[model samples]
Target: MKRGVRESIAVSAVLLAALFILPLLVIVPFRSELLTREPPMDETEGEPFVSGDLDSRTVLKVKNGDTVEEMDLGTYLVGVVRAEMPASFAEEALRAQAVAARTYTIYKLQTGGNHGSEADICTDSTCCQAYISEERARANWRKNANDYEKKVENAVTATDGETILYGGVPILAVFHSSSAGLTRAAGQVWLNDLPYLQAVDSPEEGDTIPNYYSRAEFTAAEFKEKMLAAFPEADFSGPVDRWLKNAVTDSAGSVETVEVGGVTVKGTQVRAALALRSACFEWEVQGEKLVFYVTGYGHGVGLSQYGANQMAADGADYKEILTHYYTGVTVEPYSFALPG
Candidate 1:
């Protein structure tokens, strides 16, 4: 009750009040603003952004053609899963798509996006990832629209900020509609050989997948024209059957090196030039026409949508499905931070 004791009590009271009130004043405003501002990407350093302190509600700049739109990361992911994978797919498959799509978006944002300073990502499935408005997705779903919308929304919410990571880094997470029994390797499909994007066994096959097996027929003259368009130096003047020769196939039966008109060309190039469903194809002279018996769809790299659905049907969870297709990887809540 003396003067010194009263002064100590007064100091303690002030310290306690400051501890509780100071944090709210400092944190509340920054957290709210995090939803609208661009991710702090330091361009001069030429390094991926990394930050330990970040609000959970991340923002993304989406490039929809010429104009750019900004929205919550979760909202952006829901649109991507809705556009990239069918709502009819199993819930686990949808969840896998959600995580993969999120990783792709984050990776692009951190690793010098293709759009430069304009955007973090784009809506084009070919360039970035497909994204459609909820109204349009509902219109496409029709009768089961509400259920489908809820399913996609649930998938994104359930996975939240999860992402597929390889070596503690968010990967490219490239995916396709389907695969040719087995998914293709990164080096086989693209220039870089990512360790996690190697070829792996995929379960989706047969008639269950659309265009699992298809044929593209061209007359000898038509085949020559298409081949010449890509391989201008190649000679297609020979017996129709002989023109397509020396096809070196991968273990999955996808063409690795195929001799087109005696000129060795990559199977991927043939798929591009002929507009085939996939690189896993073989050509033969069926009567007067050159027929290419193609299998599966897309570039056959990374996650396979139909394949993921098949795995989900077999009782695998989202984590299991993603890891299976992506080789050595882990599914965990992503550290939504810009790499420094």
Candidate 2:
């Protein structure tokens, strides 16, 4: 070959060699980092990705009557946040409620709900979470309808498709109105000993909530009748002082067990029989009436709404509030697509 041609061929071979070796030199040392590197997450948005095609509809059976309705998940969540949590709550608190309600609804959908016949969930706060129609919610809001509705909708929108998860599964996401000063363990209130439902400090449940403290008064006859109805075998023939004895309570001052009329009974039984506000209570017999002073307003099993509001006021966002309430959990986007 001519000298010029030979030189050109040598240059071409060198270029080919460089092309073959360059990628290996750059990629081998950083292979692990590249493979393990997660996509850049939007700090403001939190989750890495949110599925747009996830099923966002649910069937709700309203307990007022036999009315059954289906609505978009976001819309249902707005109503739930309005009905379940006070509209006066901070925006971040409302957003936390929205995520919790969404997680609960999704959990019901995944696991068969209590209402087995026709609905995935119910509007009865006793059975499920309290829910109301948008019209009803607006009506209840009355003068504050427009602003409150906008606030609730904004909360739902801000945390759209977010849920609390443990071991990659949606959590039960139970919540209540308020707490005495701390939340209760799931096992303390119910049968299940859920790791994520453990007790946590909730110091923000101050006296601001209207129902934070309540009292129920019952005459001796009335109390006897109710208790006897629940525990028919109990002997109520003794004095009222001896009627209740050996009261055992939890760390949060919630009644756990008590001896009533020589029969052992759970505090839950007494609370249910008397229609008391919460299991955390103290009772005293005053002359002709037995009065129960209840410190909290609900079962005290999970997140406290008043506490969440206080945390939000203290500058914690929705995710932080949820993780604080639900121990060993993460707030993440719904990972699965709903059935068509």
Candidate 3:
């Protein structure tokens, strides 16, 4: 009877252990709700604009930013890039750039030159590139350090979608540029057909071109003086207009034509016109040429991706960086799943 009791006790202990272990098995298969669910939408969408290809130029019209300007293809040519680039990447980069340039131009033309339906102020990095979190950047660096070549030959490419409705018009190849994490060729600051804004003395190997001054660059006194000196013609009641107020080049002065990598650019705005360069940024009037060292890149209208990355690294949140660049904007969801 005692032996029988001992066997029964041992069996009961084994059953208890099995019961405890069973719960763990169930827990092991169950993923956390946060991990399993789709991540919350990136809080960058305010006024959604479609970047599309019309005619042959690639273009984007943001809600509050400038109208869709034709993207240039020659800017990505092999010899054009100022950075030290690998020889293998030249052909692919050139080809991809050409295709994108042409596609976007077509999109603009098709939509009657618009990309946003409303003038909703953009408040997030969607109008530009998204800021990668510190942990994310570190993880990316670890995975591809010195070897993550976004160069066309090895990188995976994707289109935002084939068609997007910009201002209710159906457009083709309406996609986004540069993934949220990587800076693209579009981030390069350029003016005219030149990749680097050239100085009259000539550009050195490492000098930053197109250097424009930030508002902080000017003290209240210096700012007043420069504004007065720069535009003595009058009207200083508001902000000093730094960009091209009007086409500096007249109808006759504009480039009647432009050739990109042996292919001709097909838009009107991308003519071989005198675009502001380093000299233009400084507003220097030399020999009837508008010369000033310009700062930053692109149109100076959108989120500066490099600037955004720097801000992110400096511990500024994405919202702060977006607000700094895009004035008077609000944040919202900008998912591609929404029907246009």
Judged by lDDT, which candidate is best? 1
Question: Model 2: residues >4 Å from true position, as ranges?
Answer: 1-64, 336-340
Task: Supply candidate 1's per-residue lDDT for 109.
Answer: 83
Taking all chains together, each candidate's TM-score versus the true structure is: 0.80, 0.80, 0.25
Flag the better candidate by lDDT, 1 or 2. 1
Span of 10 residues, lowest total lDDT, candidate 1: 46-55
Q: Write the per-residue lDDT of candidate 1 for residues 1-340, one digit (tens) a residue.
A: 6999999999999999999999989988898686688787433322221211222368777898788997778888878889999999999999999989888888888788888777778899778889998879878998777778878887887887788888888998999988878998999877889998988988985687777899899988888898899999998667787888898989888898889888998999999999999999987788779988998888989999999999999999999999998888998887685433
lDDT of 3: 0.31
**Each model's lDDT:** 0.85, 0.81, 0.31
Task: Report how far residue 75 has shifted in candidate 3, in Å.
Answer: 23
Worst 10 residues of 3 by lDDT: 195-204
lDDT of 2 at 2: 100
TM-score for candidate 3: 0.25
Clashes of each: 6, 0, 32
Per-residue lDDT over 131-249 for candidate 3, one digit per residue giving the tens place of the 0 to 100 score? 22223332544544223223321211222222222333332321221111221221122323321111111111123222323212333344345434533443434433422233232
